[model samples]
Structure formats: C-alpha cells, structure tokens
Target chain A: MRKTKNSVSYNKWGYIFLIPFMTAFIIFQFIPLLNTIYNSFFENYLVGLNQVGPTFIGLDNYKSLISNGDLLIYTRNTLILWVMCFVPQIILSLTLAAWFSDASLKLKGTRFFKTVIYLPNLIMASAFSMLFFTLFSERGPINSILIQLGILSKPFVFFSSTIATRTLIAFMNCMMWFGNTTILLMAGMMGIDGSLFEAAQVDGATSTQVFFKVTLPLLRPILLYVMITSLIGGLQLFDVPQILTNGTGDPMRNTMTLIMFLNNHLYSKNYGMAGALSVMLFIITCILSLIIFKASGHDKRK
Target chain B: MENKKTKGMSVHARRTFSYIILVLVTILCLFWFYVLFINATRSNGELQSGFTFIPSTHLLENWKNLRAGTLPILSGLKNSLIISCSCVLFSVYFSTMTAYAIHAYDFKLKKFIYPFILAIMMIPTQVTALGFVKLVDAVSIFRDSPVPLIATTIAAPVTFFYMKQYMESTLPLSLIEAARIDGSNEFRTFNSIVLPLMKPAIAVQAIFTFVNNWNNYFVPALVLKSDDKQTLPILIARLRSADFLKFDMGQVYVMIAFSIFPVVIIYLFLSKYIVSGVALGAVKE
Candidate 1:
C-alpha cells in the first residue's frame, strides 16, 4: 500500500513533463491540421493585394481541383519521379550492401565507401539542387566536358528536355539517398544469423540461392520500412524539383510534383485551394501507406 | 586440385571487379563537390569559357563579390546557426524529457501516449503547412517570427520516438528510484543523472536536428519575411534565381559552398555516430 502510494505520487510528473510537447503539438501541428481541413470548406484568396472572403464555399475548391485534372497529371508525375529514383536507389543500395556485407569478399575500405556516399545526404537538398543547376546549365562543365570528349557536338539544354529534366531530378534524388538506403539495408543484412548462411552453404546452395531463399526473406521487415518511408518521402519530393525547375515545373510541367502543386496554392495565398489540396495529399498518403502495409502482410505478421 | 585453383582465380578476379566498381562509385560521389569547389575559384568569364581540371585564382574575388552582392549571405549564415542551434536544443532536450516521462512513469495515459505519438509521426508537414501559415499570420505574435518554427520543433515525433527507444534500452527505473531515495528531486535527478546517461543518444540526435533545421527552407521561406531573418538555404535559392543581369556563376558557387561548408565540417567530425545512429534507428524499428 505504501509503495502503491509512492508510485501514484510520481504519476503527476509524467503529465507535467508532457505539457510542453503536448501544448506545442496542439498549437503548431494538431490545431493547424484541423484548421486546414476547416479552411478547405471556405473560400479564401488574395486578389491583387486585397484580402478576399474566407466565406463558406463548401466543396468548390475540391471540385475545381478534380475538374481541372492537374491533380491527376501532378500525381502521375510525382509517382513516376518516385519510381524512377526509388527503383535505382534500391537496386544500387542492395548491390552495395551485398558487396559490403559479404564476409568472404572481405572488401577493403568499406567504411570509407560508406562515409563518402553518405556525404551527399548530409548537404542541404536546396544547395545540392543549386550545384546541379549550375553544373548542368547550357554552357556548364558537364556539357563542356561532354563536348570536349566528343560525346556531344553542342551544349545540350538539360532544363529544356522533359526526359533530361526528369532524369536529372531522379538521378539527383537517387544519388542523395542511395547511401542512406545502403547503410540501412547493410545493417539489416548484417543482423541476419551467420549460421543461416553457413547452413545454406552446407546444403549445396549457391550464394544467389542463399540470398533469395534465406537472406531476403529475413530482410522483409527492414525492406518494408525502407519502402514505406521512401514512399512517404517520395510524396514530399519538393526541394529538388522546386529549385531545379525554378518552381515552374517546366518542360510541359512533366517535373511537377504533388507538393509543388500544393506550394503554388500556398504561394498565391489561395487558402481554400491550398487547404483542399493538402487534404487530398493527406488522404492519398494515408491510402498509400495502408496499401503498402496491407501488401506487405504486415498486419498478419503483427 | 586444378579445378579448385581455377575457382580461386575466379574468386580473386571477382573481388578485383568489386573493388574497381566501389572505387568508381566513390569517385562518382566525391566528383561533384570537387567540381563545385573548383568552380567556386574561377572567374565568371573563365566559367563561361569552359570547364577545367585545375582551379583558378579568382576565389578571393568571388568571395568579395558575394559579400558585396545584394544577398545577405553572412546574416543568412548567422540566422541559420541561431535557428538550427535553437532547434537542436529544444528538440533534443524536450524530446528527452517526454521520452523520460513515458519511460519512467506508469501513468493512465502511458499506453495511449506511446502509440498516439507513433501515429502522429506519419503526419507529414506539407499537410499541416497551409493551416500553419494561416494560423501563424492570424496570431500577430507568431507572424513573421521564428517562434513558430522553434516552437513546432518541441513536438518532433521522430526524435521523441528515438529517445523513447533509447531510454527503454538503456535507462533503468531502479536508477531513478535510487536517486529519489537519496533525496534528489525529479527535475534535479533528470538534469544531473539522466541527462548524463543519455549523452550518446543526445549527441547523435543533436547533430541530425541541427543539420535538418539548417537545411530547412520550405517552412522558413513562409515564416521569415525579412532579409536578415532568412536562412542559408533560402538565400542560396534566391541567389540561384536572381536575374541574368546580376547573375555570376562564380558567386553562386561561392554562396552554395559557403552554405554547405559548416554542415560538411560537422559531418566530418561526427559521421561515425551519424551512420551508426541511422543503423540504430532502423534496427530498433
């Protein structure tokens, strides 16, 4: 009874400790989230330095978003960019992880390789975008080098071609992230029991077979985590494309992403539209996350 | 014996192949930063002329030009430092406190709070951005101030989750009970005893939080209106988009290098921890 009372006395400290975080979340994140939903139902925009009505206009903003069809185009673009980057990122990371984690290989300088690759991930994305922008500019070093090497007769306009622009964005994203993915997947690979591989080897299995039959199966959870997080991150792809395309999403807006579209509304102070777009984005993220979870059989495992 | 020798030769060949590929990848990763720094040292006219392997002597000229240019590069640097440092402080300290609360105490809301925070972790910032900006502007005090940016950091779910995970593994309640028995108050014990034990987790999280906040542009672009208040990423973006008449590729490179310089320095010092911290996060999950 005395111990129970003593424990009860300490309970208040938990609530007290939580107050600051809870208060900030409620004010800065939670309430704003609800406000975004609420604002979606009202008409609010700026008209040439004039504040327009936050007047009630139920479903209109969402209606226009649907009717206009840009959402579909942007969503497709976002997904395409994500797939472009994610596929290469996963493959390269997997390959690197395999090489680094292979004990028989006894690869030298694995630590150096890991550190060098992750350096890109440390730099600011916006700054990295600027570096790319300058390097791939019409008369930039990349073009000049290629021309000097007789690969191209003239400087190619990278920002002008849709394929080149999209590829560059995807490539940059892949470059920035493959190292991180490599590290995560490497850690996952390392955690598998050594005996599992030894057992496979003794059973007349090749390395490839052991990887497929034993290694990959045990790596499902980490793979699932990487994919879902990458998917969510893919949905938030903004800084690279934003800075790369100069917020134009040019080359016929092929590089335009979902967050870029939302940013346009936010930029214009079109609260209703921005709010509506944010709601759609929120829903899409939820549905996609759920679909991924379901597809992975995560629930069954749990 | 002959067959085994051939197999050994093949294995050696494959290992050599892997080393070559890794070296190539390492070059691919480091080449851009080299190019960036090399370009930073060239004159604008030299830049327009063509690419070169060797850097030129125009680095000081470019630096002088960047300082003289309309962009508030130094102020932006200062703002970024202040903002990122403040964010690191708030995020690491408060998240540790919240994690400690959840870890140590057996309150009624213990089960609920843990999952609730985990659920909240998935809610991306872009979803809350529109309303955040609106709410900020509506509340006059928060408008055009870093308060919202700094305040919002207190609820960093990722950091909190990691801290809670760390505490669960390393922090023992018996330690806290012993401290209480020694007449140490909860706050005092947390400050002196708990914080010391959490240094590794704290250091790792602090570096990440600092780098993240320093590089953050989206929310800061919306929040800070004044030139002096802008962070480095924002300034770098503006520098890139500046009109052709005033455009200097050399200065642009210099400014970007300036922005990334600090982060690279910090990273060089703490990369081991950062890499391990990332792996730790994944393994814990």
Candidate 2:
C-alpha cells in the first residue's frame, strides 16, 4: 500500500516535470513537423502583392520537385561534396585514432596535440569558412604564395572554377571534422577490452592483423555513429557554402545544396516547393539513417 | 641479443613516427588560427600585399574599425550573449529536469517518451524551417522575440540523452529515495539533491549548447532580421559579402576574434570537463 502511494506520487511528479519540455516540443518540433508534411502537398507561390498561403494541391509539389531537375543537380552536389570530404576524413581519423589509442606508441605532448587538432572543431563553421575564403581569395596569401613558388604564371583564382571551389570547401570540411572523428574513434578504441588486444598478440597476431581482425570490427558501431551524424550534417551543407558564396551559390549556382535551395525557395516565397524539398530531404535522411542502422546494428545482433 | 636490438629499434622507430605525425597534425590544425592572429594586426594594404607571419601593429586600428559600429559588433556580442547564455541555461536545466523525470519516476509513458525524444534527435531543425518561421511570424510577438530561440533548448533531445545516461551511471536512485524518505519535496529533491550531483553533465551540456547556439547562423539569420538583433555570424557574413573594396580583412579578423573570445575563454577554463564530457557522451553503451 505504501509503495503504491509512493509510485502514485512519482507519476504525478513525472507529469509535472515533463510539462515544460513537452509543451515546447509540441509548440516547436512536433507541430512544425506536421506543418511541413501538410505544406508539402499545397500550391503556394508568391504571385503578387499578397503572399499565397498554402492551398491543398495533392501530389503537385512533389511531382514538380522530381520534374524540375534542380533536385538532381542539388542532390548530386550535396552527395559529391560530402563524399569528397568524408572519405579522407574517415581514413585519416581512423589511422590517427589507432596511433593515439595505441599504448605501445606512447608519445608525449598528446594533450597539446589533442587540443590543437580539436580547436578547429570548436570554432564556428561560418568563421572557419570566412578564414578559408580570405586565404583562397585571388589576391590573398595563398594565391600570392602559389605565384611566388612559380606554380602558376598568374594567381589561380580559387572561386573562379568549379573544381577548385568544391575542393576548397571539401578540404576545409575535412580539416575541421577529422579531429572530432579522431577523438570519437580514439574513445571507442579505448573502450575496447585491453585483453582482446593482448589475446590477439598472444595468438601471434601482428598489429595490422589485430587491427583488421579485432579493432575494425569493434569500431563499427562508433564508426557508423560518426558516419551517419557526419552524413546528416553533410547533407544539410549550408553555413560554409552559404557564407562562402554569400548566399548566392554563385558561379552558376554550382555550390547550392538542397538546404540552400530550399532556403532560396523560401526566400523567393515559393513556400510549396520549399516544403516539398524539405520532405524529400527528410525522406532521404530517414532512408540513409535506416540503412546505416541496419548495416551496423545487424552486425551487433549477430 | 640481436633479436632484442631489432625489437627495441622497431619500438623506437614507431614512437618517433608517432611524434612526427602528431606534431604535423598539430601544425595543420592550428595553422589557420596562427594566420588569423597574424593578420589581425596587419593593415588592409599589408594584408593584400602578401602573407606575413609577423604580427603588425594594427590591432588597435582594427579595434577602432570593429567598434565604429558600421556593423553592430558590440551589440551583436551582447545579443549573442543574451541568446546563447539563456539558451545554455534552458538547454541544460530543462533537459536535466526532463531526463530526471523520466529516469526517477514510474509513469505510464516513461518508456514511450524516452524513445520519442530519441526519435526527434534524427530530425534536424532544417526540416521544419519553413513552418517554424511561419509559426513564429504569425505569433507576431514571437516573430523576433528571442523566445523561440531560447525555447528551442527545452526540447534538446541530445542533451537529454547525455543527461539520462549520466543519471544512470552517476546518479543512483537510492540517493533520491533517501532524500524522499527525509520528507523533502520532489522539486526540492531535484533542485537541492539532483542538480548538484549532475554538475559535470550540466557543465558539459552547457558548453556544447553555448557553442552551438553561439555559432548557429541559420535560424538566427531567418528570425532575427533587424540589424541590431543579428548575431556575430550574420555580421561576419555581411562583412565578407560586402563590396570587394569594403572588405576589411583586419576588421574581419578582429570581429572573428571578438566573436569567439568568450567561447575560447569558457572552453579554456572548462576544457578538461569539456573533453571528458564528450568522451562520456560519445562512448556510452
């Protein structure tokens, strides 16, 4: 009876404590999610003096999204940039994490190294993007150095070409993220049982063999976590691209990502198209997340 | 003797290699910051001339440009502080309360709510951007009120995840039960007993939320349209995107410095906690 009373009061306190968060969640997150879903099916465009509120036009917006072909270009840009950044980031961070986590490779000043590497991760992406913009500008130091080095007769304008612009963005992203991934990977590695490494060594395993056979398998869950989060963040490629291009996604709109495009759509008051793009983005992310969850999660279950 | 010598040589080679890699990486990571600092003190003429690793004497001049308020740097700082600090407070405090409620109590929806919150983590605010802006604009008061910005923290699912994990590992239920037995009220128990115990988690989440909110440009850009209310990121963007001749790299560097100064200070002081906090959050079972 006493225990029952205690639990009853616990339930009441639980509801009380939950009210603030739930209230905000409903007001902010849940409603917006529902609204996005609702808006996606409408025909809303800024035609004249008045803003056209979303009106029901089932399947029209989504249909236009696929037909417009901008979806393909934007999606391609987002994926290509993400892949360019992520491939190098994952490989370098894995090796570093392995090297750092290895007790056998004990080196001093790691605290300093860790802080330095992670420093870029802490800075605002906009600020970092700004830094890169200055560095790679036509008259900036990078171009000057290249000219002085006799690598080019004239300054290689970074933003003047598509490949150069993409590469710069990718390099900046890789530099910022590898440190974070290293820390996470290192922590994941550290959490692995020491005896597993020892046991592999005892069984005449080379360090390479142990890493491939034991460490990589053990690192899967964390790696997937890092990858998926990176992918999600990578998918919403905005701040850097947005700032770097001054919200123009200029040079013929080459750098414009899905989110940036959606942003533009909203800015132009093409509310229906923006909603449709958002839904598509949401669906893409959900699919990607599910695939990753299955791939890593299946291994764990086995 | 020969085998021992070879083994020792390999170990020594490995350690040296590790140090070289680490040093190289450190230089790579910090090179831009070094550049940012070096250029902050240079004149626009000096900056456009070439890369100079040397610090020029124009920091004070840059400071003058920064405070001239062609862009509202000082007010941006104040607004950012007001926005991010309150954001951190709401994020850490309310997230903790929500986590505590779920962790400590026996409610019907406890099981459901836990995963429900986790599910929301996968939904980035970008997905709801259009509707969020619409809702805010419709409310009129909330349109640029800073309420939506601060209130967004209350539903911080990631912080709740960390705090819940923290509660499980560090905050034993027995202690709460003991407090309850002593006739302390539920809120009192949470306020007096629980919060102090969750200091480390609170500190960790506070730093993350602070940085996230401080650097957040997208939502703030969309919502805070007024020049006076715009944060540093927006201001910095404006500086960058300005007419080419008007782009002052020195002023830009100083503004960048000014924008991140508080964050750097906070991180420097709480870095040890920040590192551990990330580890605690990342490697959780």
Candidate 3:
C-alpha cells in the first residue's frame, strides 16, 4: 500500500542532499585510503639533486621496514606510554565515577568538580606541554621548590632520563583525560539496571560488594569501547611529546611515538617507507580490533 | 542512647571528611591553570627562582613582548579562528544535512553508505596522513594555505554519528510532512525548519569541534609553514623551543594564556553539554 508514495522521485531528494557529503568523503577519505594502499608497494629513491621517482618493488617497502628494529622501538614506546597513562587514568576515573555516582557518599558539588576536572582537556596540549616544560626546567619554580624542600641537593634535568620523559608525557596525558573517562564511566553506570543493584543490597550485599559484582560487570562493554578508542588515540600520540621536546622526541627518542616516527620518515622524503608505516599501522589496528571484538562478549546491538 | 549518638556523629564526620577530600582534589586538578595564570603575570627573571601563589605585575609587559616578538601571535590567533571556525561550520552543517537525509528519505544505497562512513572511524588518522598529504600536494594551488587542512573537515564521521543520534530523536517525519504540505522544498524545509531545531546539537558539536580544531597541531603544523600562517599552538611550540637567551618564559605563558582564553570562555558557558554529550556518545555505542 505504501509503495506507491515511496517511489523513485520521492527518494531523489535524499541523494541530492547526500551528494555534497559523499563527494567530500570520497575525495578526502576514500580516495586517499586507496592511494595509501597503492602507494605502499613502491620505493622512491633520489636520483639527482632534486629528481626522485617511485619504483614498484612489490612488498619490498614493507620488507625493509619489518627488517628494521625501529618499528619495534616505536611500538614499544607507544604501548608503554599508553599503558602508563591508561592504567592510572582508568583507575582514578573509575574511583571518581563510582564515588560521585554512589548515593551513599552523597558527593557535594558534583557539577562544579566535574566542570573543573574537564577544564584541563579543553586547554591546548601545547599550553600544557609548555607549562610542564618550564615547570620542570632547571632554575624554574619546580626545581627551586624541590631544593627548598630538600628533595634534591641541586638542580636536576627531568628530560635527561628516558623514564622521566616518558613518565612526564604519561602524567600529562592522564591529567587531561581522566576527567573525560570519569564522565563516560559515570554514564555507563547510569545505564545499569537499577533493580539489580537494589536486589544485591536487599540480599545483604555491602556497597563494595554491590559495586564489584553488579556495576563493574555491567560496565564491561563501555570499558571495552573506551579502551579501544584510547588505544587508537594513544598509539598515535604526537602533539605533547612533539611540542614538549621540539619534535625531536629528545633524550634518545624515548618519547617518539608511532606517529612521530611516521612523520619523521615523511619529512625525510621517504614516501614509500612512510606509506609502508601507515599500512603497518592499519594492519596492527585491524588485528587489535579483531582481538577486542572476540574478547568482548558478543552482545550484538539489539 | 549515647552509643547511637556517637555512631551518628562518626557518620557525619566521615561525610564532612569526604567533602573536604573531594574539594581538595578538585583544587589540585585545577592547580596548573592557576599556576599558568600566575606565571603569565610575572616577569621572566621573577619566574626563575621564586614560587609565588600571588600574581606579580608583568602581564602588560609580557603582552608587549608577545607583540614585539618574531612570531606573530595576533595573526596566528586570527588564522586559527578562521581555520577552526570554518572547519567547524563545514563539518557540522554538512554532517547534519547528511544525517537528515539518512533519516528523512529512502534511497537505494542508504544502508551501505552510512555503515561505510561509520566503519571509517576505526581507521586511525595516521593511516590517511601519508596519502592525504600527497593528495594535497597534487592539488595544491597556493602556499601556506589553510585550504587543505579545512578540506578534510568535510568528511567528519564522528560528527555525522552525533548528528545522526540527535536527528533520530528530535526530528520526526510528520514535521517534514507538514512542511511539505505547506509547499516547502526539501532544502528550504531543512534550512528554515530543521536548522532551527538542530541548534542545541549544533552548539554542542561546534564547541567540541572548535576546541579540537583550534588545539589541533597535527595537520596545521604540517600545512601552515610560514610564520603568518601558523596557528597559536604552533607559534607557542616555537616560542617554547627558543634558546635560553632568546627564550622569554613570560611571553610563552602570556601567549598560552591568550590561546586558552577562547576555549575557557566557551567552556564556562556550555559546561552542561559536556557531561550529557559524553553520555550521548556512549549510550549510542
């Protein structure tokens, strides 16, 4: 009966509105993606002062990249920094989310605290990195304060040590993101069936028991989603580490992430290797996503 | 009776203790912004040795230094505003229109088209950076232009998803039907009728996109090479890397203070959307 009105002309309007977005998406995203795959196989070498040309070697680019150990170092650094940031971030956010959302605590001024906590994330990472850079610099207030407190005998360089640099990046990342994680986790908690918590409490479960048994289990899907997003974002870490260290990832490149490594290769005019690196990133992302998809309970959306 | 009263008193004490602790933590979280503000007000020499909770009086001097510096802060701010505002405008407007189309009308390739866009979200930005740069060079018409960077805003999957979620609930077919009955064309109905209704969603997304693009150092750092073309974050990063003799910490702090001003002001007015916005993104997932 409804098929008469839902005819071809009626549907023509959708395509007209959709054409602009589709044009942009295809040009910017889809074509480039295909270009990335096509370009990944060719090797470009400089033949003269300025002339360079692509020679298709068919997997030679990926072969050379894989043979090198720099990829491992980059992956290691990315994972380590991400783990350092994410472990603390998720824990603190969960604690904060649980405490604030719990009725018994009756946390005061939730809105104000939430706003303040999220404030750091809004400020540019360039500012945060610069602020921390100065704060930790020798003769800066941090060093002065440390000496005054007798924590150090004299001035010390925080960037000198790899651990220190990595820790600093990790800390800054956590500081900026935990508030967002808290809000997301709180939203997840809000989605939990209220009667389940009530049933647990009615069965003589303590607050801790209820939280551990009831709330956490229900939050698994949200946690998985958050973790996957963080994994992607964190692996591509560039700005803070780049700006804070003059894009050098200084002190022996301890803080250089996968994106930084990729950017460096691109700048040096090694387009083939850069494309290969991007493809490598894509492969790793797909593998990890599959692992997550399997590990996460197969709760297909209703 | 005394035992019961003492238990009640202890519970009251615990609540008070919790409040004090939470408040303290909140202040600790905000301490850096305060420190940044304070340092922005102090001279380079004063910032060297001493830590002061109270602000000193070098803000005007610092501003003067920023203006006098090699890197043009004001121009950077202007370029950033134009780039970000334009990106946000294009991103949200097109995304909403696309989502509206998906919601309102039936087309042959509709199902395949939307999920394909959603699927792109899984691919990291780095995956496309290499090819995207090559494409820009292949098509570049001008040097130090923000056009290439702005062009990428056209394909914003995240904004599309957010707008899709919004249009699902807020928009109804009957409204479109009524508008059609009144002899409104599709584009007219969208521009006149639908856009007004999407103001709240637009405002929330605009804030998110503005902050993201304004603070974005990735693409802008790549494309905007010339001093005048550089955005605030890039300029600040340069100032930050200045040699000791050349480095005036005062200018860095002041420039940072300037960079943060727009976002902080916007955040203050729209803090409410943030919590709900996160929830919106999460629940749909």
Best by TM-score: 1
Give the better candidate number (1 or 2) by TM-score. 1
State in Å the error of residue B134, model 3. 1.2
Error of 3 at B117 (Å): 1.2
Q: What is candidate 1's local distance difference test score? A: 0.90
Q: For residues B1-285, write the lDDT of model 1, one tens digit per residue.
A: 996686578668878988998899899998988998899999999999899989999999999998998999889988898899999999999999999989998999989998999998999999999889988899999988888999899999999988988988999899999999999999998899999999999999999999999989888988898998898988877876777435888998898888887888888888899988988887856
Show the lowest summed lDDT stretch of 10 residues, model 3 chain B: B3-12
Question: Would you list the C-alpha lDDT of every candidate in the order shown?
Answer: 0.90, 0.86, 0.84
Tens-digit per-residue lDDT, A26-76, candidate 3: 887778778888888888745456645587889988988889888888899
Q: After superposition, how far is residue B181 of candidate 2 from its true place, in Å?
A: 1.8
The candidate that achieves the highest DockQ relative to the unseen native structure: 1
For all candidates in order, state the fraction of native interface contacts they contain.
0.77, 0.67, 0.74
- lDDT tens per residue, model 2, B1-285: 996687678878878887887788788877887788888889888988888678999999998977884898888888988999999999899999999999999888888988889888999899998888888888988877778989988989999999999999888889988998899999999999999999988988988998999999888888888888889898888887788556677887887777656677777787777776777789755
- In order of DockQ, best first, we have 1, 2, 3
Off by over 4 Å in 2: A48-53, A297-302
Stretches > 4 Å off in candidate 3: A1-3, A45-51, A298-302, B1-21
Cα displacement (Å) at residue A48, model 3: 9.1
Candidate 2 docking: what grade?
medium
* True-structure RMSD, every candidate: 1.5, 1.6, 2.5
lDDT of 3 by residue, B116-217 (tens): 888887887778877777787787563468887777787788998999999998998899888977888889999999989999889888888899999998
